[model samples]
Target: MSLRAIATFDVSTGGGVGHGLATWFGAALAGPLRGRLEQEQQGTAFFSASTRATERSPRQEYQPLATGWEAMRQELLHEPETAHVLYMREHLGKPLVHVRSSTIRVRRPNAEAQLLFGADCGSLDDVAFCAGAVEFLVAALDTVNPAFAWLGADAPASEETNLDWVLGRRVRDSVREARKLLRGYSWTTVCPEELSVRLGGPGALAATGAFHRVVPLSAGGCDPAGDRDRGGVHRRGRARCLRGPAPRPAARCPAVRPGPPGAALLPRGRVPLPRVTDRKREGARHADATARAVFSG
Candidate 1:
């Protein structure tokens, strides 16, 4: 049977302790996660579910998920990879305090691919940090990503799920109401980074190549070297033309034309990045039509 893949990422970094410390301040067990990214390939995970799922147990103690993201972010520091460690330190601002949770959907790979929800905290600096972070991320992932996680990151089943345990109380309430419609055991560890996760299988390998081609416009006046890397920078700032009345000196619109590899300028303004796949197509279709109608009316 086909399964819908859901992964949530949590990127929250504020305090190093609190009821949250069980998750956040928990230091990572000393030692690197062993193995480089390409060498490790992936973490060890079992792909089979031995326990048959049924209704969630009543009186099932519920753990408080302040942001739902904290649980996952901490886990990222643990386990393999010098590159990931360096990558986190480099971009996330060393001693990264930021937390981000994301989920990526890997479709039935034309090749071999599986959806796995993951969490990593950029704040982790020690072993205690790893201890807490691991359990939390594992909890969120096992609960949401059906393709990965047999337990832990997930609780067997709860009343369905929540994408955010914080900043999403309304959604959580609505989730409770929606529970009446779902059959089978509803896993409820709470998927937090639902929005930032990827969704596609090996089908997305195409995306890796294509994403590079999408080239972000240098609107913020990027460095000259950055321009060289991003392919010659395009005009910065907003545009008022493109299809409007006419070109006037007051019109801040810059022209767009085809150029050589390093100089190709896409239609000057903020080009709405194109949805190159079906998953992207779905995301593009989610605009608030009712709100749009009201605004237009």
Candidate 2:
């Protein structure tokens, strides 16, 4: 089964933390992840596009481009080795923060090569690995630079919410939805850099013999990368482009902290992330129940 889900965050102006931290975090985690990437011949990567490239690819097939993100799904399918981290040229430009630890595997009969997310397509180890990468990246980034409050760095009142936390919220939501669709699968835990506590779930694991794709938050089209710059460094102070609803004041919600060992990171307390089914809103109910139980018990 092909299971996919997306969790999107509306980054406020100047919400993007500087690229310097991303670079530093990427390098620090690269060495530990190198062993895994070496084993698979490809570790992990991040991808984004420029406003100019995104403008041209709106109608393209197999690859879609929205002003928010430039999809490289097709290119990734063709060049798995090309995976690398990317920061958008415009910090407030609605960036696509994609991370994957996937590899090329041959399909049967035609023996066609394809790339799928989640290491080994859903093994316990695969789940652990994917989770580990996300955990490390989120922790490193959030601690180093939380997402800036709405309206950029100069906003007089700083919002308690950061980019990493918001991004993690989206990821946790998506994983909850996917898990509902993919229950009874094997599970594993990976905490390479003690970041899993920050990400919520350990990782989504693919079951044995299960052929699947882990499409995290992505644009709607498919074509691959073209003769465009893969990633670009942008200067701050660009015009603002708000796509989603305005973020509420952080004061409205309590701050989220790093969750405990083997627990999902939520503002309230420890609870496992859920898979969202048509009945999944019940999952939210259940999550609330569980949180209540934890507190009340």
Candidate 3:
């Protein structure tokens, strides 16, 4: 059966059974998209709480910040429910795309044709997207009802309150379907390897004892990654890393560029100026090479 059909059947049968059906379906269908609705319940309490926390003490150390899109993604990875809600909000009100509705003419006892409702099957890709979407809803439900994830078939028959096991099973099945669909396409699950590298590698996003304040670069402005004024000192070198307070080099230091390969132009010694007694003809020859390399570029 198609993924949409599977999801639709669960929603239909699950809803037909009771009073909380509409609420449950709304929660399920809305999923992470709740924040976009502007209504109270739809938006998460996390955002509200965070906002209040920020307001209470503006300079509080507990304030969370993201440096860039990649950093923001890392934060989201740590908070899946919040991420899903925001993700849904990002793509709010887009067509479901999987379930196509139509009406067909059927023969009636009065020798007249009457309209009957029907559905058009969606493509596998559409089904896969739907499956992914439904997985988000399942997660949202699980969040509302604690321990929903742990409840399973092997646990106990007595433990299946409100068909929690059934719902859990449905979610697991849908997730499996999503993974299967994903294999057929190029989509893959995102993990923390990239984040780990970004945080720990030599050219890490934030260096040790370094403060990173994210500032947006306007169009036509210097890229932040290369802007020395905002960056920290290069750990392994005397020069400042990109985004640090390295001065504009064009008018002032005609022969000096702050970072490599420009750095190669400097002589081997740490200090460029030597005492009058130590300055020799050979030093002049080295200076000539440095000048040639620097000005030639």
Candidate 4:
């Protein structure tokens, strides 16, 4: 089995699930995951849908967001139950990394948005990237303001059950390394079932100052043991909260190339570009992308 990590959020409030997804995507591309996704020359974003067969043949569905990021954002902002967005990095016609988001439906009362890594075509191994992604999601709690969120391998099951199916040595090592780097953070959980119960419902959890706030476990910092006793949750690690306003695209960011006529305007505030200062750094980034491709392959 391959290594996997999931971050689930209760995005039923605020702007609903679609808006939450848009916010999360923008933050991800503009923040920690920028180096991996923006620098690549070949990338594609698409919506997946199932088709029904008619008496004659199967009918095709016209997807507006299939064009690019600008269109995708527009749909996500307006649609209530939009198709999940899948992003892929391509090299020589082969896929390197695949990032996917959860789909929100109209009838679902309490919709949730989930960001998955290494669950589809790839296995997450970059410790730095994994840690950065987790940090970004935790910080995003303020803007997206999901009632409850947690990050860890698989779903909110017992640790033993979650890791029981692991058969490969490499996969095991990846899981262990991810835990080591992510432990001590309040949202990082080995078993989400226990945390959810302790935290109570979404309203109660949000009132605990855990959402939209970064509570680290350091000297004089928030205490997990004490928090647990007081009907709260805290881990034994230190992480800085991404304070202040949302980040804007730097001047050095790549200019949005003009698409064909009638194309939607790309949102400047959310666009993310690689910031390469020197040749050595560029080479290193490329090497990292290659390593990801190798691992996924």
Q: Can you tell me which runs of candidate 1 are displaced by over 4 Å?
A: 1-169, 173-202, 205-297
RMSD of each: 19.4, 20.3, 27.5, 20.0
Worst 10 residues of 3 by lDDT: 106-115
Better of 3 and 4 by lDDT: 4
Q: Please, what are the lDDT tens digits per residue for candidate 4 over residues 83-200? A: 3433444333322222344323212333334455544433344445545555555444444434334453333322211221111112223223321222112223321222333334
How do the residues 186-236 of candidate 1 rate in per-residue lDDT, one tens digit apiece?
A: 111111222112222222312433221111111110000111111121233
TM-score of each: 0.18, 0.23, 0.17, 0.40
Ranking by TM-score: 4, 2, 1, 3
Q: How would the candidate models be sorted by lDDT, starting from the highest?
A: 4, 2, 3, 1
Candidate with better lDDT, 1 vs 4: 4
- Candidate 2 residue-wise lDDT, 3-61, digit = tens: 11111111210122222223222432352233332332231332332111122343322
Alpha carbon deviation, residue 66, candidate 3 (Å):
30
Residue 43 CA displacement from its true place in model 2, Å: 14
Query: Which run of 10 residues does model 4 get worst, by summed lDDT?
Result: 288-297
Q: Write the number of the candidate with greater TM-score, choosing between 3 and 4.
A: 4
- Which has the higher lDDT value, candidate number 1 or candidate number 2? 2
Judged by whole-model lDDT over C-alpha atoms, candidate 3 comes out at 0.21
Between 1 and 4, whose TM-score is larger? 4
Off by over 4 Å in 2: 1-33, 36-53, 57-135, 143-297
